[model samples]
Target: MSVSKQADIAPTLRPPPALPADGMVISANFSVGGFSKRWNHCHQLANFLARYASANEDDPERHATLLSTFFNELLEAIYRNHGATGEIKMRFRKKQNHILVEAEVPINEQSAKFYNHAVQLANQPDPMAWYREQLEHDVPDDDAQALGLLELAVVYGSKLSISEPTSGDWLLLAIQFPFTEVEEL
Candidate 1:
């Protein structure tokens, strides 16, 4: 018998409370087309945000590159897992020594399950090993793999979580980076 670690599907995911404006905050919403219509939009948006966010870092150039890579990974996940029609909302906030990137993605049941499963795997005790196993094996359903979340959690010491389903079918996924370490890298 196989044991399953899937979470009970929630009716909706609630969005996080607005972060205080003590440091820097950037918020944007885009039509689904901005992502689905053109694939490169992910890279474009990621590069733009990363550059702006890393401007004051100790090693701005390297930090920008790191941010761009993770941001692109996140956008790619949204591009692949979103519903047919809905806006993609993004929030990036920096306060004290922490940085938070929150995304509200419109999702159907299928996509919700994908995110939930990914979160489960990312939070596992040996997520790095699981990530390596995934890289070595063949995963037919690539969208469900959640490789980006795993990489962020395992390699960068970022935290991955899902919370507050919107009134509609949406998943609020958050990736938090420890700014001190991120800048050092």
Candidate 2:
């Protein structure tokens, strides 16, 4: 092999140092450590959006728009209609480049049906727009049961995966949003 080729193929002994910030959340199902404890997952995610927007640092309106977009999806666990009372553990983690949000929601007999319906909608190619059409033209009272998953899939292009139950009734829905942070010039 040529000398130039050898240099190109050599392994990097030292990986790039992680960010100096030390922030993250620690939950049973989720833990975030990289930025700082002061900054929550939502904050981190919003920052990514702001960076992507290339907006001014102090621009409240830009930040608000981005935050709203992220918050709307984050509120899914709140309006979830379970058959019985159960706890859903939400996990938000900051990876090297992007943020990951997960929800471990319990699946009862009634909620299992909801899960099936949601899975179908989420897997559909045009779920979000289709649901909107249903609301606009056909059914005014469309429940929009799968809006969260649909938006995550359609908007952020997030890779969403649902894990099957292994030990208990809890179903794991994980959303990964890959982002690149803009360096300060």
Candidate 3:
């Protein structure tokens, strides 16, 4: 079933399936990472992921920049939405024409619902308008966590999905980025 449809029917929405172990370019477990350093970590990880993913592209710099922007957005969303305690694991793999990112974060059932709601919003016909409305209006704290995914869908054209909760309270999230088109942006 589609991730959105699965989310609608299942109350235990969690993480995506494990990313293939063979293709990982980088992975990190942020269980002990200080919350104060999340901004730095997110940007640094994004830059590294972008650089590695864009190495063979024509305009490496442009592609890396674009990738970094979207990657940081994804990382920031995890930082904002994850539950209080658990390993936030992130893994990246390079595909033929895109980069696939899989993340498993500790999230409660309520947060899972919020994520599903955000995905639904992002899939709407006018996501950009909804994104603009989010920025212009004061949203509740829970809803504010939805903005990054919305921006990724609306502004960057990334594809996102979530898997059913597996093993524990972890929420699996998958994001696919078609980096080849970045140079033209």
Candidate 4:
């Protein structure tokens, strides 16, 4: 007689705050080696900041404000390090500030990494299966595609693929930009 051992599978982590039905996903693609390196570093920094902010829960608003400030400062540092001399093109939306930085030196490696990652994520299981299910259930293909793409961007930082359920036909191919920050609306 053989006994079967049970293995515990980790639960899939959902997006922090549930995404809205009509939420929109916006993306911008760039080609810069140094900028990509700095961007990846900034990404790690932002993750750390978020973890730190969540450590305490006395004042959620204060935590958000501090996190935003830290994000701005980190982006500035990354921009300056990449030789950005003039006024940086930074955009402030409702909850986040976005800075666009350009590099003087061409960064082929960074560009390739970003491009490849985007392509890989586009074909992942979660996005494809979820979208297919929605489409088969008669949800508007466009809406399902948009929502799936947005979720993929937030979760994996790049490409996503969706399919229609009934016909098992691929419907959407989406690539998303790496956003610096995301918060509840």
lDDT of each: 0.78, 0.52, 0.75, 0.36
Ranking 3 against 4 by TM-score, winner:
3
lDDT of 2: 0.52
- Report each candidate's C-alpha RMSD, comma-separated, in the order given: 17.4, 10.8, 15.7, 18.9
Per-residue lDDT tens digits of candidate 3, residues 12-112? 34444243323666776778246435566668878987887666556678888888998888877777677777677888887756678888878877767
Cα distance off (Å), candidate 4, residue 170:
31
Tens-place lDDT per residue, model 4, 1-185, is 86655555555444344322223222222333444446646655444544443333334454545444444443433343222222222222222222221212211333233323433544555655655566578766334324433344444343333222243211122222233343432
Off by over 4 Å in 1: 1-22, 140-144, 166-168, 183-185
Please, what are the lDDT tens digits per residue for candidate 2 over residues 1-185?
A: 55577657869655553432222333332222221232346545545543433232244354445444654464443235332445656665555554465677666665566666666766678766876675576542223666665666566565566675776466776666543332220
The prediction achieving the highest TM-score against the true structure is 1
Using lDDT as the measure, the top candidate is 1
Better candidate by TM-score, 1 or 3: 1
Candidate 3, run of 10 with poorest lDDT: 13-22
lDDT of 4 at 35: 48
In Å, residue 67's CA in model 4 sits off its true spot by 5.5
* C-alpha lDDT of residue 26 in model 3: 76
lDDT for 114 (candidate 3)? 72
Alpha carbon lDDT at 159, candidate 1: 81
